[model samples]
Target chain A: MRVGVVTFPGTLDDVDAQRAARVAGHEVVALWHGDHDLQGVDAVILPGGFSYGDYLRAGAISRFAPIMTEVIAGAQAGLPVLGICNGFQILVEAHLLPGGLLRNDHRKFICRDQTLRIENTSTAWTGAFAQGQEIVVPLKNGEGQYVADAETVARLEGDGRVVARYVDVNPNGSVNDIAGISNERGNVVGLMPHPEHAVEALTGAGTDGLGFFTSLAGVLA
Target chain B: MPKPEILDPQGKAVLGALPRLGFTGVTDVRQGKRFEIEVPEVTEAVLAEIAKMADSLLANTVIENYTVRVEQDA
Candidate 1:
């Protein structure tokens, strides 16, 4: 499968995401933010970064990038889209996902190896893991707290749209300790942690994040 | 100024007990840090530069957003 990683001007994690995709046996396609075409890639990743220098708001400007128009259309057609960190913010800003991220309750930039429980494994991006599985991935962000109306939260819970929950500690005071979520159809997933940064065991963060990329192989097969 | 997390365990413990100490109507409270910067003169260019500094370093635009105000010291 060809997986495209979109690189906005200030995107910092596109390379890492591309490397992870290659390691997972997918042809990695580098997509630019201004391009309206997806190059026929089977899946896409909106990698992390301070896109547009987070000028107006984190991911606020990037959500309207020309490439997102194509991404939105592809995602609607059942193409998988995985958004990490800033990319997740773009997804929310675009209304492709529910909820918004706020500053950490503690009000500081936090960086740590965060533990997360895989809450829903049936999504196209998480099918490689068993539900309730515990995995550790690096999380570094200042505004990682997630919030939404109580009704939306309840609905997400009721529909099994929540894909991951913080374990051990709620790193950013996300409502209900949510660490990640998927769209109702499960083709789109967004999380604040840098799963690509945790894909290699030699890197010391463990390779638990590989499941995200490898899960696509199963879906494509 | 950015609000810091209440990290001092003892401080948090004391604040946590304030509501029980008859401090009624205290909905929520968190500790924070305060900082002051002195600018030689305030100008549109200078203020814009400060905003850039805040965006680039003083705040992590990803998680923390900032508000800036200018006041002349008497």
Candidate 2:
């Protein structure tokens, strides 16, 4: 499988995401924000960063980027798309996912090794994990709080669309401690933690994050 | 403005400081953004257009709502 990592202005995790895909035994493709082409990759990962300097709002400006037009269409056609951290913001802004992320309740930027429970393993990104398994990944963001209307929240919970959840502690006051979610088809996933940063034991957080990248093989199988 | 259910930390912080400054009687405070657009003319169509822009980009409907108002030059 070939994985494409998109780089928007101020994006800081594209290289790490590409490396993670490579480590997972997949060829890596680089995608750009200014281009509308996906270059024929099997999957796309929107990595973390302060895109457009988070102007107007986190992920607001980047929602209109040239690449997003293709991403939105491709995602609708069942392309596997993973959005991490700032990428998650863009996904919500593009209405690819329900709800929205707002400033953390504490009104501060938080960075730490966060524990998240894999709540759903059927998604394209989480298929490698066992049910209710806990994994630690680096979570860093100021506008990381997840919010939604009462109806949307209930629908997501009832449909099992929530893919992952914060465990032990909710760092950003996300509703239901939601750390990640997946679309109805389980092809599109958006998560607040930086799994790409945890792909290697050399990075100090262990190899848990590699599952996200490796899950592609099982998804395409 | 942020939805009634959404927590507004910035407003909370401002509320915390008001009593210390001797301005007591303020019940609550919510911080929000205001945008002033200079349109060529303030028609119903123009206002509706601006409202649409606010809906799509100027505000995140999930967390905030916006209103467009026209002011006459003094």
Candidate 3:
């Protein structure tokens, strides 16, 4: 499958995502934020970074980029989209996902090897993991806290749309310990951790994140 | 309720300095924002529009809520 990795100004993770995609045996296509074209890729990945300098709000400005129009439309049409870290913020800001990301509860940027429980593997981005699998990946960000109205939280839980939850400790004080979630259709998954960074054992904390990339093979099949 | 989940460092700072500045017995401080939105001859339609703007953009409904008040332009 051909996976398009979007690059916005100040995007630092597109390369990592592309590398992960290549490692997972998928063709990697580079997509630009300023262009509306998706390059006709089979799926899209919005990688992490300080997109738009994290100004106004994290992911606030980037949500308006020309590429997001195509992403939003494509995602609505069942085109798979995975948003990681800052990209997750963009997904929520774009209303593709519910809830919002606030500053870390401690008001500090945290970087560490974080553990996450795969709560729902039916989503397109998590098809490789068995339900209840625990994986360690890198989590680094200031505005990484996930928040939503109580009713929305209940709905996400009841609908089985919550894709992952923080394990052991909630690093950012995300409500219900949520580290990631999926849209109702299950084609869109948004996670605060950087799975791309953990795809390789040589550089990353572990190969636990390889599933996020490799899972696409089944999703696209 | 001033969302216990939302940090109020700014408000806490003010509350802390109040005692040193000789303002006594003030129990708490809840800090927020104010906006002077100018509309052409404020009408029901305009008020609704402004409210929508706040709900959709100005305030993040997840962490914050806002109130709107309109006054005549001097």
Local distance difference test, each candidate: 0.85, 0.93, 0.89
Per candidate, the number of residue pairs that clash is 2, 0, 0
- Give the candidate number with the greatest lDDT: 2
Which is better, 1 or 2, measured by DockQ? 2
Q: What does candidate 2's lDDT look like per residue over B1-74, in tens digits?
A: 88888888789889989999999999999999898788777899998899889988999998897777789866
Query: In model 3, which runs have C-alpha deviations exceeding 4 angstroms?
Result: B1-52, B69-74
Query: Model 3 Cα displacement at B13 (Å)?
Result: 6.8
Ranking of all candidate structures by their DockQ, best first: 2, 3, 1
Q: Write candidate 2's Cα lDDT for A1-221 as tens digits.
A: 98999999999999999999999999999999999899999999999999999999899999999999999999999999999999999999999999999889988899999999999999999999999999999999998999999899998999999999999999999999999998899999999998899998987488889899999999889
Candidate 3 is graded, for docking, as acceptable
Q: TM-score winner among the candidates?
A: 2
* TM-score to true structure, per model: 0.76, 0.97, 0.87
Q: Give the per-residue lDDT digits (tens) of candidate 3, residues B24-71.
A: 999988677676788668889988999898876666666676788877
Candidate DockQ scores, in order: 0.05, 0.76, 0.37
Misplaced by over 4 Å in model 1 are: B1-74
In the range A1-221, model 3's lDDT, one tens digit per residue, is 99999999989999999999999999999999999899899899999999989876688889889999999999999999999999999999889999989778776789999999999989999999999999999999888889888899999999999999999999988999999999999999999999899988999998899999899899867
- List per-candidate RMSD values in Å: 8.0, 1.2, 2.9
